[model samples]
Target: MISDTAEYALRAVVWLVQTPDESQTTRQIAEGTRTPLDYQSKVLQLLAKSGITKSQRGTGGGIRLNVSPDGLTVLDVINAVDPIQRIHSCPLGLKEHGTCLCPMHRGLNDAVKTVEAAFKNTLVADLLKTRSKSVPLGIDLPLRAPRKPKQATA
Candidate 1:
């Protein structure tokens, strides 16, 4: 499972990719991504620190993507906020066991690898193309009511 911060980071990145306009203020980014302004600001700062996004100050300045959406992977965004930690050593801390993991841990680590692979292969651009119109990035936006069919004149 990923952290809320990571989720917010991903949403913010995806929103930026989708918009691809001028730099956006923290408030705008938070509103577009449906994340809390306070928390989103922190997430944006972390992103800027990681070089995933660039932050500007003063007039005509805000935040924008530093890396191209096509070049940026989901893993990159996730790592910016909450890196997917891998099991490197035995949890039991057995000297004889050394760095080797038990069968259970081995399986868990393998699963982690699988997840990493999926994230690595997924790009923000790809997500934009395949995202559901019903719920973008799992954030449910207000849907418009269906229009009534027009009747033929007599």
Candidate 2:
């Protein structure tokens, strides 16, 4: 699973893709993605450092995606923030442990590989295109109706 920072980064990237030509300030990006501005700024810096996005300073300066959404994968954003670490060998570091892992660890490692491959293959543009129309990026408050209070019986 990805971290909160990764989630925020993905949201920011998707928001940028929605307006590909326009650069957005951290404040605007945070507001648009409903992410915390402070955390979002750090995530933005990581994205910039990873070369997934470009940043500028001073007036009219902002951040924008450096690559096309179609070419960028969800794994890119995740790696920029919290990389998915695949277990290549036995985690216990047993001296007698051979190249083959125990059934349990092997299955876990296989699952990780599967998830990694899925994320790596999923493009940001594809995510946007395949997202539910009413709840893009899984952020639609209106989809859930507010609970009604019950009146006390007399």
Candidate 3:
């Protein structure tokens, strides 16, 4: 299973691409996408560290995609952040001595391959364009102002 942080990172990248505005700070990115500010902030940092997204510090500092969305595949982001090893190695982490997928992971291999293929084929830009129709699993909210926090802790 993919971590929510990884999912949010992918969403952030797509949202950033759909309507780019220079570079978006963590707050701005989370606010517009209606995601948790703190969680989004952490994901941004991870993305920056992975080289999929770049970040600047202090004033005028924000985040942006390192590569053009059109040129970046979903798998690239997935591998960079929350890579799902495709299981070709081994479910039991066995040494390289199998003729094919072990019986325990036979059908699973095909599923993993299908998922890998889908991720490999999907480009960020391509996914963003589908916004008007269906929302991606990673992002559930529409672009808009983030909900304002309560003035008092009460």
Tell me the TM-score of each prediction against the true structure: 0.83, 0.83, 0.73
Question: Model 3 segments beyond 4 Å from truth?
Answer: 88-100, 135-154
Name the regions of candidate 1 deviating beyond 4 angstroms: 131-154
Better of 1 and 3 by lDDT: 1
Q: Give lDDT tens digits, candidate 3, residues 34-151.
A: 7899998877877888877877788876777666776788888877767776556566666763546676687787787788899899987677566555676455433332222237
lDDT of 1 by residue, 70-108 (tens): 778999999998899999998889887678888888999
Q: Candidate 2 lDDT, tens digit per residue, 1-154?
A: 7789989999988887766555789999999889899999999999999998888898867887887777789998899988988777778987566657888888888998999899999988777666466555555322211122236799
Global lDDT of each candidate:
0.82, 0.80, 0.71
Give the TM-score (vs. native) of candidate 3. 0.73
lDDT of candidate 3 at residue 84, scale 0 to 100: 73
User: What lDDT would candidate 1 get against the real structure?
Assistant: 0.82
**Residue-level lDDT for 19 in candidate 3:** 44
